[model samples]
Target chain A: MIEEITSTQNAKVKKWQHLTTKKGHQKFHQYLVEGWHIVSDALAAEQPVVQIIATGEQLDAHQRELPENIETFEITPEIAKKLSDTVTPQGIFAVMDILASETIDPETATGAWLLLDRIQDPGNIGTMVRTADAAGFRGVVFGNGTSSRYTPKVVRAMQGSQFHIDLTHGNLEDWVKALEARQIPVYGSALNDQAEDYSTVTPQADFGLILGNEGQGMSERLMTQTTTNLYIPIKGQAESLNVAVAAGILMFKLNQKLA
Target chain B: MIEEITSTQNAKVKKWQHLTTKKGHQKFHQYLVEGWHIVSDALAAEQPVVQIIATGEQLDAHQRELPENIETFEITPEIAKKLSDTVTPQGIFAVMDILASETIDPETATGAWLLLDRIQDPGNIGTMVRTADAAGFRGVVFGNGTSSRYTPKVVRAMQGSQFHIDLTHGNLEDWVKALEARQIPVYGSALNDQAEDYSTVTPQADFGLILGNEGQGMSERLMTQTTTNLYIPIKGQAESLNVAVAAGILMFKLNQKLA
Candidate 1:
């Protein structure tokens, strides 16, 4: 039977609201996925979706598409608004479990991995994850100081690519050492005298690419650990390219050589 | 002498606040550039910075960087917060005049040009403009249905690249006709049977690249007018690339051939 949640104070409703924060997400081991597109992608990928919550209108519009086994809750418009991050609530959301099984043992890892160091903007972090997926990256490791992968904004911007790709959180330095021990080249994106032009390095089937914080490039210690650093040359007066865009260019260009 | 604005309702303060909206920006032919990095870039580029407004601390910290001829204002904290779009306000802003004189005569245009069609995200729009600048594109044109170039969010994301490149507004269909008349090749970023892999086509010194709306790509009419459409192949399960990221990849790759 489909349950109805008329009060925002209901235990389930309050618990769902808690998913909005990192601490709550970590404690509950769940995050909220909003909008039809994302929710549909989650279902298609067979991710663990705990419950589908929606307003009466949204339930009527999309109930037919949902799996029969999943629990459903009809919530009030007020409750829907409280749970939504966007101005116009899509009125549909899914409580999804974090991919706890996808953690990588870096010593055993191979193929291309994207390592992010303190990427601050939720949109940039999400876009890089999605781009890494599109470029056929094996997995993504969110280094220290990076935004939480399960943050509502990051989840929204990732557009379900998170389900298709492996994501793990760890110290990037340790991951670098592990990959290096496996004889995989760890490339750092840094612009300095010693950095080689990205075009000069051919993309390999197995490698690790490290991108850095928005304001600061890769930390000096991390850069020192890289096998080599790469830089994208700028021909015009603009000082730098948006980090996400740079990541995209590098990912695709390197992957293109493999093709 | 530096004027002071203690009231949020001060005439100049109110006028500056209005620039935050698209309609007001169009009516006033001005926009606000915030943050020291962007404001300083605007000043260095010799763009028409009508006035420099800052908190007393900011004014004291950056007074030496200001050009001697420009007018200055010290605004109250409340007024600064009212004018800022960010959470932690930078407490610095420049009221910059729109480039009313830089409209393109497409028939006589030469070198590379980036034409955008109905891109809605301010961050995406501004990042594309900045990317175009870094790739040494001659200009950027905002087509019908796109976000306003002078919106505060767009201006902020652009990071003062607007000062380095020629930005204009026009009907893309008209611009297409004009470029075709001049025998300049026009490329559309679209995925269709006729579209070629972007890697196959060499980037030319003089060409046009048109990117489209986030949800719906370039309109059918505009696609029909292009010399050729290009597609960046995705190797993994992800559906499509972020529009700004795709543009960056294309711009730099095409520009690399030029180098």
Candidate 2:
């Protein structure tokens, strides 16, 4: 049934607003995905979309893309604006349950995996997840200090790649040990003399690539535990590459070796 | 000489504020670089630092790094906040004159050149410039519709690489023709049947790599005129790579081919 919400104080509107915060997301086990593209991607992937909220105009424009079986709410433009974070609201949003069941056991992981070490930026974290999916990596592990995967900015940046890959949150130190115990070589990205040139390393079928915080890079303690630390050589004057760009280059290069 | 300016209404303060906007930057032929790292980079590169502004604390902390002969201003914390766009003011900024004199003539361009086609995001534009610098590209040409190189956000994201390379603005169509006439192969990044895998192409000493806008890839009219269009193969489900990440991967891969 289609319902109309005119007041921001409506129970359903209040509930959706709660999903915007981390604590609210945790309490309810759901997060909001904005815009038609992300909402449609969730529906297309058969992910659990609790409800879709949009203005009458937006619903009319995207009726063909919306699944008939899913419940949807039509809100006034003012209400839609209150639900959005963007300056120009797309006027569409999907409430999706957190995809935590797909989390993998590092001890039994068999394919390539990406380990993000305290990555702080939502855009960087999301882009890395999307790149990991493009590289055909089996999963992504978010270390302790990283941004929450369910944040609106991150979900927007991931572009629905979360549905295509396993995403988990855990202590990176333990995960590293687990992967190593399974014979999956773990490589940490760093910029020191001890770090081998990334291009020199041969890619393998299964491995763990660890990327660290943007400003500080991989923690020194974590670097010591990896099988080898790799560095991308700078050919020009730029001191370093953006963390996401660096991650993409490394992921694709290593994946190419297996191909 | 060091001078204290307690009021935001000071003539110099008013002028510096103007540099924050596009029209002001154009009128003064100068742009603001924030944070200690970028300011130091500008001074170290001798990139025509017009003046430096900082809170007394920042000036004292960075005394050793500040150029002794350059004009410096000591501003109050309130004034510093007013001059900054970030939530937390870095308390340091440098007014650097535009470095457009180094613009290369495409017909005579002899090194790798990055052509940005209407890329909108300031961060994306800046990261691409830094990546180009790291890849040892000679220069970057800002095509029509690209973000202004001198914007505060772009300058911050570039992380001082702007001082290390030549930045020019011009019509991409004309630039492409000029580069081609000089036998400098121009490559357009696209996802289409006619596009060759980026890995298959051999890197050359002199060439132009065109990256398109975020939402729309390269303009269709411009894509058709390139010598060859290249594609980065996506092994998994992501629709595409982040523009900056894609540029970085392509740049480093192509640069590696030459090495």
Candidate 3:
């Protein structure tokens, strides 16, 4: 269906604006992805992109390539600005359906995966997702207390890496138990005597690596459940690494591809 | 000397506000560090913290430990808000002098160092500095076009890692040439057929690693100048890793402590 949305106060526009917020995303079970790159990625990946809204100029430019069935709206530049998070709106946006939570069967789950334990920064969360994809991880789980993957800032940060990997939210403790039941060693990140230097560990084909909150680290309960926690030895005066940077290092270290 | 300045319009308060800008820091060669932790870190490092400013409440809380020789001022909470970059002002701030740039004599230089080529984000620059410190790098050279280390946002992101190691601004072309003159292998990050996997390169105590602008990667000229550009082989679909995260992986790869 094709329609024009000229008023910023239109009911549909108001609903779309709500998708920009966490509460709105949760309530509507939908989120917005702005810019041509993200919208194109969603379409190319065959994700559930339910709608595409763009300024008339943008629609004219991309109209030929857009899929036929998705709902399309022509919006005024003013309406575009109302829905924008960035200072300059790219004028193209998509409404993506949030994936429903599904159970991961211990019997069938394989390949490396990343788990977040209360990792709250959207930028950090997004970077970790991209890094996990780059490291060839099969998926990432947003554990309890972790920000929703559907948060606009996070979806923006993931740079369309979301389409390349599975992202879901679940209790990390349950994730640990599942991976363990499958006989895959799950690694938690921390610094202590029991935490082995990350480089010393042999890279594995199938494993789980859990990164924790920006401030407090992995919960003690989850730390004990992992096969072993690993630490990237800090050789200089820096007390710790940025959570995203730390996640990148550990993911790359534990999941290098076999030649 | 200690004095009370109750108004945000006071000359000192006005000047302190100016210090938050790039032009102001350049003109006066001074930048402000807010919050007690950063302020205290500056004092402990003894990094030419010339003036201390705080509200009466905060001053009373910390006055006993402040150095006797440094000039101190008491200001109203209104002035505190004026100087604060954060929403909730910590009520303590310090003025720090920018270090004078000195020639890096290639003959005397040793140990791993990071080079930034046109990298502009303060947060990325600061995170890279902290990662450099964590990886035990000797220093970082902010090449031409990179954001100033003295930028308030950069300093805040660095979390005082600036004091733990050397930070200087210079032309990266000269830096690469200088390191090469001393028989030090300088590596630029990029992925091409000619580039070697970062992991294949033996870790070195004396080396230089160059990271480039987030979007463009290293300039083609500098890419050719380095001993050999390094590539962290991405096994999956991410277009690229976050610049800071890439730096963390490379720095840790090239500068691991010898057993």
The iRMS of the candidates, in order, is 1.6, 1.8, 2.1
Q: A1-259, model 1: which lDDT tens digit per residue?
A: 8899899889998889899889888799998989898999999989899899999999899867988799999998999999999998989999998767767899988779899998999999999999998888877899999999888899988988998888899899999899899888999998554689897888889899999998887899999999999998887778888999999988987886443
TM-score of each: 0.97, 0.95, 0.95
lDDT of 2 at A223: 93
- Report the number of the highest-TM-score candidate: 1
Off by over 4 Å in 1: A257-259, B192-194, B257-259
Q: Write the per-residue lDDT of candidate 1 for residues B56-156, one digit (tens) a residue.
A: 99998997888778899999878889999999898999998876676778888888989999999999999999999988888899998999888778988
Q: What is the TM-score of chain A in candidate 2?
A: 0.95
* lDDT, candidate 3, A210-230, per-residue tens: 998888888999999999899
How many clashing pairs does model 3 include?
A: 0
DockQ metric, candidate 1: 0.72
- Kept native contacts, as fractions per model, are 0.76, 0.75, 0.76
- Model 3 chain A is weakest, by summed lDDT over 10 consecutive residues, at A99-108
- Model 3 spans with C-alpha error above 4 angstroms: A257-259, B192-194, B257-259
Model 2 RMSD in Å is 1.9
